[model samples]
Target: MTEQLLPENVQTWAQAPLPTAPPEPTPAGRLTIASVPAGHPYVRGISGADDGVVRLRDPLPDPADPDRWWPPVVLDAAWITQNADVVDVVHVHFGAESLPPGRLAGALDALDAAGLPLVYTAHDLTNPQLADQAPHEADLDLLISRASAVITLTDGAADEIARRWDRTAVVIPHPAIVAEGATPPPGRATGAFTVGVHLRDIRPGIDAVGSVRTLLAGLTDLRAAGVAAAGRVVVNDRVRDSDALDAVAALLTDRPDCVLVRRPRVADPELEQEVADLDVALLPYRHGTHSGWVELCHDLGVPVVGPRVGYAHEQHPDEFTAFEPDDGVSLARAVLAALARGTRPGSGERAALVQRRALARVVQHRAIVRAHTDVYRTVVRRTGASA
Candidate 1:
């Protein structure tokens, strides 16, 4: 079959040779998780900082370029070949983020060759709305047949995978990591309402040239509607070209407080603190479900003001004030209202009630690890392979 060409934004990479494996151990009960990128926010939320149920390993570094999810994921060849029995169950974390074609194929093929029981956790694959959906879906189906159990970030995502693959996914949305005893950042005297768009997933079609046009149009309507506020658009990699970014910068150059801070994933915690300092946060997303961005805001107790698309509603906390996607005007209104009448951390009664609600629906860390453990055990049982 001819290889499908990637979008202008995506690219390919060389496949690393599979890792060499040790002889099978009949007496061991270990499981190996094939994480695409270690320390990814999703992984961190799911694994909850590695508590003793399954061994996790990845070829990628802790802080790889967050925006560049395309290809060259840590030499997987060295991984599968070298660390075959590193775990009893071979749970491969697969998603539609981005990767080299041959690299993904090689990883699955190697696992098959090793006679390992495979489990795939689908994060965001099969969403045809994504730019590279065709290839992503093809790879997902190819990998699905080998899956012992499918884990997904949202119930909707799981259902979609099941419908496409004809197999059920164990629904396991990523958990929020509570920052215990941490105080919110100091409020800015003259704040710039922040809208954190981790611009990696944002396509060039909505650049400053285009997105700014949308925002400006929205702002005009918002000002007319008497609900406009001054704020900076916080970004990590919103623009693909420096010139495009410069144009975006120029749009804000006249504003006294408009700022752009190039933040690495490692620096995101501090960045979030800065974002929390703002009165309101915006997603301004065009498409897709299950946002790590929204969850981050909720965990930080930062109120969100985003479009009613994808998983942005997951952050609404209720039915009111959810803005429609791509509407700068409505989004601006949501932001203005939250900023103008500052949100109080729920009063003591509300806080306690919220905690109880959180506890009731809590996705415990142990539960997440145990879910993987069960998948491992099930895979081992099904494959009847020597551990």
Candidate 2:
């Protein structure tokens, strides 16, 4: 039999090369970056002190809500004009979904007037939070057309960007979410496999009801086959009042085999423990580009079953199993395939692997940070030379 070849994007991720040379300093002794939402884990993972780049703290639009950074203040033309002296370049990763095309264009015009180059990371080609795709596409059209450089996490996304806007984007792998040397929880007792489906607040991109039902169906089939299996559904307390939550509850009614967990949004440590306790994590995204959840599960050494919609599979091809979105049978097969790969490592092996992966992430993170620095320097230089 002929060996099946992996997709081009999968191969690209598998063979992605890392930069070893030390990064050069910025033309300015130290460059300050105005990351739209600097508090996000992905943004923090790709930034470091040694890269000659400092990301400014996210502006507080609402004083009462300190954690909120939506409708990023730096995207405002007025904010950019006032802070132009301190911020060398604007690197927008998220929060543009909250802005209309006209406002985002005005912000880009401001950056042009101030000679501040824009480096946009296409994190979400299709905004997962919104039901409609047109608004997000409009935002992408403006941002990509005006950006001095573009960055994306997966090669698949890069290809899409090139095809859509005729622009090339630098591909950088997502860094580990769990901190270095972070240990995964001990593996669960043998003979019982747990499948987890976290429908946190049922975002527009997530098929919460469908995912839960599919998990229930899959678990039922597994049990009928004499393979011990259980399903767990996790949802945020904030979604309790929503119709999606009601639908999910109705599905779980009288299902003695499935357990439903409800809680507020959790911090990293809590989340890590939660995911580490499961045998497999199910990603229920109906439509979106890429996922940090996949990265989180990888960091915890837990296998993930994700939809084939985006580059989630490409993110970690070995650890990820793909199923068609909203298809129960496909999900069942994917779950079975994932569990059949064998139990996650024992405690000692898990600890050692986590340490080794952590060390590797440190190195890869440096490369990611260096890549951002290089983009910043290149854009700044081009802007200065033209001036």
Best by TM-score: 2
Which digits, one per residue and each the tens of the lDDT, describe model 1 over residues 194-297?
Answer: 44333432343223344554455555565676643445565545334567566766776665434455543435556655654554566555555555566555
Q: Please identify model 1 stretches exceeding 4 Å from their true place.
A: 1-30, 48-52, 60-82, 94-100, 126-130, 177-211, 217-222, 225-228, 237-239, 253-266, 315-321, 336-363
Q: Any idea what lDDT model 2 has? A: 0.77
Compare the candidates by lDDT and give the number of the best one. 2
Each model's Cα RMSD = 6.2, 9.8
Q: After superposition, how far is residue 322 of candidate 1 from its true place, in Å?
A: 4.0
The residue ranges of model 2 lying beyond 4 angstroms of the native Cα positions read 1-28, 187-191, 385-387
The digit string of per-residue lDDT tens for model 2 on 128-200 reads 7778898788889999989999999999999999999999999999888876555656555444677888887
Error of 1 at 358 (Å): 9.1
CA lDDT, every prediction? Answer: 0.53, 0.77
